[model samples]
Target: MPPIFRAPRYLGASAIAGRGALPYLACVITHARWTSQRWFASVLIAMVVLIAVATVVGAEMLSRTTEVSNRLNDRIAPARTAVAELTAAVVGQETGVRGYVLSGEQQFLDPYAQGRGDETRLVAQLRGLLEGHSDALADLDAVERRMASWRETAAEPLVRARRSDSYNVALVTQSKEAFDDVREPLAGLDSKLAALRAEGRADLNDSRRLRNTAFAGLVVALLVLIASIAVLLRVVVLRPLNELSAEVRRVAGGDFDHRVAPRGPADLAVLAADVEAMRGKLADSLAASRQQAAELHRSNADLEQFAYVASHDLQEPLRKVASFCQMLQRRYAGQLDDRAQQYIGFAVDGATRMQQLINDLLAFSRIGRMYDDREPVDLDEVVGRVEDTLALAIEETGAEIVRPKLPTVPGDATLMTQLWQNLLGNAIKFRRPDVPPRVTVTVTEDAEKYTFAVADNGIGIDAEFADKIFVIFQRLHPRDVYSGTGIGLAICKKIVEHHGGQIRLDTSYTDGARIEFSLTK
Candidate 1:
């Protein structure tokens, strides 16, 4: 590598750490243009860019380190070994030549012969390994030149003289000097190879360090990214969402005037505006409903007052007319003609029927209107009172009232008694001719509620008129057939409903009419 381009070859951990995103993030977060979408998107893109850069740089560093390691293993180390082998070969040649000269034996020439071949092969191998390395090649060339000079000027001459008994001490000393020349270059060549190996290892170490620092930076950046995302969500969404939810809950808790004001984004603010508008509408509707309820309560009070006053006022005139007519019938019994007696009779009957109508009307109107009594009323006792009230009818019609031991219910005792009397009286009144009425009163229970079923074996009400029967003044039978104001079932319905119960005719009961009603425990 050129020195000019290798200025920052090994940027250390601090270089990577210094370029971290914290400073940039602080600037970005405080920017007015940094919104939720932009914050997340920019951070995500930055993260992806960081990861890609780290991956590419790490891979390049690993490849470069591997290349240098391979050079040390496959080139520099082998070249060094070749250089060492060449040096050993040179020493062997010097020793073999000296030994052959001293002993004047031809067998002593073997190592010299073998050493020349080894040295030639090693030089060629080292040249091949150090092909692109000028320093190593220059060292190899010096060693080769010196070895050739020794082979020509010392080794050959010494061996030749030993064969002829012409080798002298002066010639041996000159040959030894030539051998030192070869040894010097061999040492230089070995040192040069070692330097190359050391450089390759150093390059490998630097690459590994750079790669490690890059990956560390990536890890730190990942953590920073996660923290940034959390901050963005907390600031942009979660906190605002919590505030909005609290405002909505407050409005729902009957603080209808608490305005919903949302922050953060335009979309969220628009949604809050919609909610506030709805709250306004709801508040207006609530106020209107309260006004109507107060008006309805006053109207109901006025109607109750009118009903109480009207019944009392009308009862007096009907009673006096009825009384005077009865007196007339008794006093003029012989003097009066048949038509006159019938006229008096009609007057008395009309007055009596009018009085009965007014009484039934008063009773029906009083139900669920004036009473505030709530007590545990023994229904069995209520049924007993109803039986006594209808004793004459029950005995005349020979009706059988079968009942279980009824459970006590929370309600007005008078209202409950009236309920039973109306139901039982209807059963007895509407009995089939020549068929004794059989009324069964039974109570069934469920979780948190009781269902009381009063069934009667009599002329049952028609399915079509089942709903109409419970309406005030609604009668299915003619006036001549069923003689009473038709408000009994309506009163029973009002009583049951006032106690938070429901009363309905069981159309499924084929044997007779069954009135089913429910009361919560």
Candidate 2:
């Protein structure tokens, strides 16, 4: 409370607040560096790397297996088939040679000619197939030598002897021995080629099995990687967002007292800190608002007290002045000049009006004072009573008050009655000279409030004076034309507002003045 401390106290408080925020500020700094964006990028990069590595390994394994299978199917199997065909060709040639030697006919030599061409083609194919296998190629070369020697020594001799008419049994016996030699080497080569085919088939099966295993392993690895990424994303991103959403809902529900705690990833923590800062500002603003409201309430109470005192204490003096002026007017009317009489009349009228003004001001000031019990007051009853209170005016002006059955609402009954009385009286008082005053009071109910409209076929208030008409002492017409303290609408406004509702002129009514008000039900 000392002078020097008081001025600089706020500075110390602000320093303390800044210090309090340092932890959150540090958290924000850490959050930016360790952001969720970085986390997602890392996961994505790792996934891509894993996929690349797996793809490379799988592709390599598949390539090697495919190559082995292709070698067995395309090269080794076809080579064995070629070797078998070569053996068959040699046998066919020897059979044709024997037929020609036994029958001494040239027609039997036709098979030998065809077999010779087939034998050459088969040998060439076998050599090409065995190119990479040195052991197999050596066997193929020995078979080829035997085939050439047999063709030179047996087949050519038999065919020439049969065609020249010099073929004999002795020549036939030599051809048989040559064919026997050829058959022995051809049989050996066939056996070796069969074994190679068997080995190739076995290797092909193994290669296929290995390829299937690698493919299955690759698929499983991909599934596991996808699952891990999904779990990581849910834990690192989705769960944090869900928690932040819940905290946001709590703050929106007006629980500003409970600060949101930092949660999940660094980014979420930063968001929570920012929300907490906003909550702090809102709490401070609310506190300041409450303080200002308290000050305003006190000021209104003081003003009300002043108005009450002035109205109550000054009434007797105003009454005496009015009474003396009336007495002077009645007792010495002829003795006074016309100007003196007019001055006296002015004083009397002024005092009476002043008294009326004070009374009206007091009534206006007393609105919203919680002295009476608030209970459910039926509008039907309130309107009925207000009608009776203005029965004389209604009769004089022939005003028709068409009011429907209305709902009951909560309010001080006397105040509700006064509110209706003032509205109905004004409607009758402000009737247009050309038209007979017609008033309609209707009620509409909603869940929270009842809207009661009092419309009259009278001289309606202009749109420009709609707001001004509710102000105290604000009149649209001269006092001589429409007699009133000009506090009727203002009093109605206060009463409606005191009951936690609003009263306004319905500008949509073009035929006449329509005043609408609401009361909580």
Candidate 3:
């Protein structure tokens, strides 16, 4: 197929896709604009980045802090180890002295020699530990001097007592007392250094805790920022877009009068201005069009009235001329030849039929010309009057008219009566000879209108001739076959239309015809 022929399908598909995608796209754009205005969104993102950076920095700081702590801890370990060794040396020295006093053995002197050697090592270790702090170094110096004096004083007495093979208890007791003095002061110095080491560990723990708290606070700030951004986007962007969409839907659904106020970002202001301009243009164009339509309607009404009056006036003269001609033909037939009489009769018949046709045209034209006054008309009563007028026709045709209960409607009573009379009479007149006319009138009511249906079992019109039947002088059958002026249905159409209603053929065939009309209730 040619692309041109496929154009309509492509256009329809494109329109459908556009309609489907527009709402989603609008929502996305609205959300994006909202996000742009969200202070918290930007803040949240920045905070997250900052928190990540801080986390790295804090981790590095923690590592360095821990290293410092470890170095401090390492310094304390050796001093503590040396203090323990010296205390053991003091105990061994005391035991050795006691052993010499009791056994007089030279093997006991071995401990005394080891103790003297350990005394020098202990002093050197203590000095190394106290190298950085003056107060701690002073305390270590005091402890060292006491240790040297006690060792010097206590060891000489013990050696002399052992060499003489006479162990002096008093001298040994004095030596033990001096050794206690040295040990007690050394233990006090060790306690002070141990307290300092504990303080350093506590500082390390505090630093680590502070770093963790900083990171946690940063994370919390980031979370709060993100939440704030989300709220801003919803209020600033989504809300305005939704309002615009609702207004647009109203406009699409034939409410072109609707207007949307500009809101949200600056971009929407331009759109709102354009929409308002379009609305104004449409309103102006509609007003001008309505004015033109009113003028045309007035001209049509004038034309109809003129035609009705002209035709009605012509009908009386034409009727009289036909009646006189017919009288002359009947009265003077004996004096004239057969051909002359026949021609006169034909002229009279043509004039009489033209008169009838003119009268029908006048009736059709006068449907709503002088009958604008509307009053409540009982359709049932109208139907009864039509039945009375058509009683002889109905009897002759053996037609049965069936009607449902009808309602009172606002319309010209005379026109409503005529409307029913013409429709019902047509049904009876257009009956098939072999079958009795079965005409039924049904009524249906709605909120604003009432529908009246007149169905017939008769010589129904062809589908092609259905609309033609309503036009003036347009006949489906010859005058000899169907006696009609051919303006009945046309009058019915005009009457219904004048009352703000419509009339149409519901169904029609050679055997039957159903006609329906509606009027405002």
Name the best candidate (by lDDT).
1
Query: For residues 1-521, could you state the per-residue lDDT of candidate 3 as single tens digits?
Result: 11211223435566533334333334443554443335445666787787788878788868867875875666676777777888777678777877877788889978877986896788787787768767667767776777677767876777786788676777788888887777766777778778877877777777777778877877777677777667666865677677777777777687766655445554453354455556656766878888988997998788776676667667677778888888888898789998998888788888888878776766776677667678999888888988999999888878899888889999898898888988998888888877889998898888899888888988787777768878877778888898877888888888889999988886533448889889997
lDDT tens digits, residue span 1-521, model 2: 11111213444556534436635454554644466778778877877887787788778767877877777778787887887788777787888878877787778778878888998898888888777887777777777787778778877887788778887777777777877877776677777777877877787687778778877876887788788778968987789788888888987898867766656667667776777777778878888988998988898888777786776778888889989998999899889999989999899989989988987887777777643558888878988888888988878888898888988888888888889889999889999996779999888888888888999998888898899999999988888898878999999999998898999999989989999999887
Candidate 2: regions farther than 4 A off: 1-32, 52-65, 102-108, 127-135, 158-210, 242-257, 261-263, 296-381, 403-416, 432-435, 440-453, 457-463, 477-482, 495-512, 516-521
Off by over 4 Å in 1: 1-45, 68-82, 103-131, 327-336, 343-347, 372-396, 403-417, 442-449, 499-501
Candidate scoring better on TM-score of 1 and 2: 1
Listed in order, each prediction's TM-score against the native is 0.80, 0.75, 0.55
Instruction: Sort every candidate by lDDT, greatest first.
Output: 1, 2, 3
Taking the tens digit of each residue's C-alpha lDDT, what string does model 1 give over 1-521? 12111113465545423323223322332342344566678889988998898889889888988888888898998888887788888788888888888888787788888998998899889888888988778877887888788879888888888788788888898898887877776777778777888888898888889888888988998999889889978977788778888999999998987867535544454455567667778988999999999999999889877786768878889999999999999999999999999999999989998888888888877786666478898888888888998999999999999999988888888888888888889888888889999999888898777898888888887788889989998888888898987888998898888888899999989888999988766
| Quality of model 1 by C-alpha lDDT | 0.81
The model with the greater lDDT, 1 or 3, is 1
Instruction: Name the candidate that leads on TM-score.
Output: 1
Q: Let me know the TM-score candidate 1 reaches against the reference structure.
A: 0.80
Clashes of each: 0, 0, 0
Global lDDT of each model? Answer: 0.81, 0.80, 0.75
lDDT agreement of model 2 with the native? 0.80
